[model samples]
Target chain A: MNAIDHPLVTAYLDAVARETAELPAERRAELLADLREHVEASDARDDDQVREVLTGLGEPRTVAASALSEETPAGHIHPAPVAPGRAKLTVILLGCSGPLLLASSVVGTIALIAGLALLWGAPRWETRHKVIGTATAVAVPVLVFVGALLGAASRIGPIELLLLLAFSLGVPAVGATVLLRAVRR
Target chain B: MNEAGGRVPSQLRKGLLEYCVLALLRDEPKYGVELVAELSAVSVMTTSQGTIYPLLSRLRREGLVDTELRDSPSGPPRRYYTLTAVGLASLTEFARAWPLFRDAVDHFLTDPQGDPA
Candidate 1:
């Protein structure tokens, strides 16, 4: 039979139809059609399946609530344009901060400061990654500066200057790469 | 399992249930009952059969699913839901991400004593 002869099934479908009245006309019609078909398909003679189906479908209000919230199949809403742009900007700033450090300290300092601020402000990155990224970005260059001054005082070779450059540049570069991967994940 | 009557599973399912529907349709088109039965097989996923309909409706609106009314063997015509290409792509994406997400959560849960930072 196309329609459920059972009073319980009829009443349940009626409740769902009434509760979901606020849904768009097409959606409401589709929902009722679907529910009605489910009732008709089940072995109506078996009381247990009837109860199980009804219980599984839950109350009409709860069912409506689930659909009302805008969850996409990917399990998240489309992120705001600003958020994605900000996240991209943060990663770019982090990556660029290191190479800029090789330039004049003033420009390098500005990039580093702006990068650090953006990294911290970004919602995409985990706090742990941000903290580690910021700390390495600051500490690696400062430590290299202090070590270079000490080596200069001791009259070291040009090799020492290159070594200083490598350490200063490499740490933040690696840190930023790792952070980009982590945040994107 | 809502045996505990906790609201947490319901809340968690809110995020996951739509993907579950898409994954169900990934194999073949199914009617509402078949879809609900498959999803309800996992008790944590749903408490009510009726709830999936609204989700199906939303998926239709989002252009992830399309429905067609076909004559059933037993009764009045039945509305069968088919996954759009968009739906298939979304499911594929979710399938890729879920394992990595599960592993990440597992790592955090299993190694609670690891680096606090």
Candidate 2:
């Protein structure tokens, strides 16, 4: 029917497709065809009118909501309504408290190790391990910040936050292990 | 005396949506737009294409009706909805029960003192 010739109709269809690509192809085609018919039937014959109709249909998210199955898909669970808000709050809290927590814990651990080593007249290995562990512990947050920076710049998905959390916590624990090993020897 | 009666009886026409839709589609396949238009014409069932489309999709998902895309001469492709065998069986069940249900309610509202049994 040469339906795609009309620029406005074509644009609207493209928008619908972009918003609804996750849907089954058959369902997506059905919705697009119905919208196409509506646009064609309306007497208002310009881009502005077409846009008005699409706007009245509401946001692409709302339109997509109508087609989504009730069942949650695997891997990409639709978060509960409060989940995004909660996630944002948690991220902010973590961002603020994370470095302080790491720094304090690292300093405390190093102080304790140094105190013990000094009391025992320990070898250079003890001093070196304490310094390295303290530095590594402090570096963990910086590594996390760098990872977060990359995530923000690249527009990575939420999974990146999990990666950041793991790095932020894992590095310090590894440092603590090195110190404990030196103390044991 | 009032020329017209009081409010229309709710019992006479209430909750017939599923029955009405199935009945309409029993004869032949119809698409979203056509079904909405027909239902709106018959009763005070005013609905938008958006509303009808979802209901149709749900009906299809529930195995009540089957849908297929066909090229439309006038515009883009059309989604034609045909009653499935399960849908027809359900329709028959609804048809048999609807009249009895309607009459039972009608008797209570229209003839309060006529039958106590």
Candidate 3:
């Protein structure tokens, strides 16, 4: 009934321990101890039950992978690369949000929010680009509103108003687009 | 088979099996074999009973479960796993969230229209 008496059980435990060699020593010890206890206590007198027990435990590699996943981040378990198309779409949306702001305020606001979310969520963009995109998102609108207010107070021409809107929105929009291109992976 | 054969069930079991172990220890401390037997009896919850050892090791590392060695009546000294206060709190939290999550999945699967009603 003891694991020491059963060569198969000892071999199985040894295999599991070897597979998990890279794990922390304390954890590896615990795992081996648990397996050894389970095998020794099992009432499997026949070779069939022993085989079943081993199979139920699965291959050593599979067990090791499962244990590794527990230790690492879930993202490490599955490294899903972002598609180039998605990255391109993010760039396009981020650039368009500026011009969209001029067309219709409500639609532009929705587009701007969506673009910012895409920019922030995209794994392809570096932190710097994301920050620039966010800063541009906040700054462009405030500058435009202030410019429009000042132009109105001075009784500026319609041409001046249009020019102010273009300048205020255009500068950051262009800058952000360039920065995004520069920092993209 | 899909690209990852049997991966769906494996992934689901991976996420839920630790909680199942915590739930098993809710009433009393159990030795590793007893826990494996209970889980294997459920069948769907586990594919390989031996894999539970690594999971138990994780629970111990996470401070959710504690183990103690005791003299057994028939064989070698047995290690019994008991739920810690942190483990009990985690199980309670899972109990609260499981129903809402199950019902949401059920609704999504049953209602193709994605209607809230």
Q: Specify the highest-TM-score model's number.
A: 3
- Any runs in candidate 3 off by more than 4 Å, and if so which? A1-4, A73-185, B1-5
The numbered model that scores best in lDDT is: 3
List model 1 lDDT by residue over B1-116, tens digit each: 34623787767777788999998888789988888888878777777767787788878888999999888886678888999999999999999999888887787888977873
In model 3, what is the error at residue B117, expressed in angstroms?
A: 4.0
| Candidate 1: regions farther than 4 A off | A1-3, A46-52, A70-185, B115-117
Off by over 4 Å in 2: A1-36, A39-185, B1-14, B47-49
Q: What level of docking quality does candidate 3 show?
A: acceptable
Clashes of each: 6, 0, 1
Candidate 1 lDDT, tens digit per residue, A64-176? 65555533445665532225566666656666665576666777778788888988776667778888888778865577477677766377669876776787677777777
Candidate 1 structure, TM-score to reference: 0.56
Tell me the tens digit of each residue's lDDT in model 2 across A103-155. 58565445434433432343334457646654555565566457567767377
lDDT for position B24 in model 3:
100
- Candidate 3 lDDT at A49 equals 80
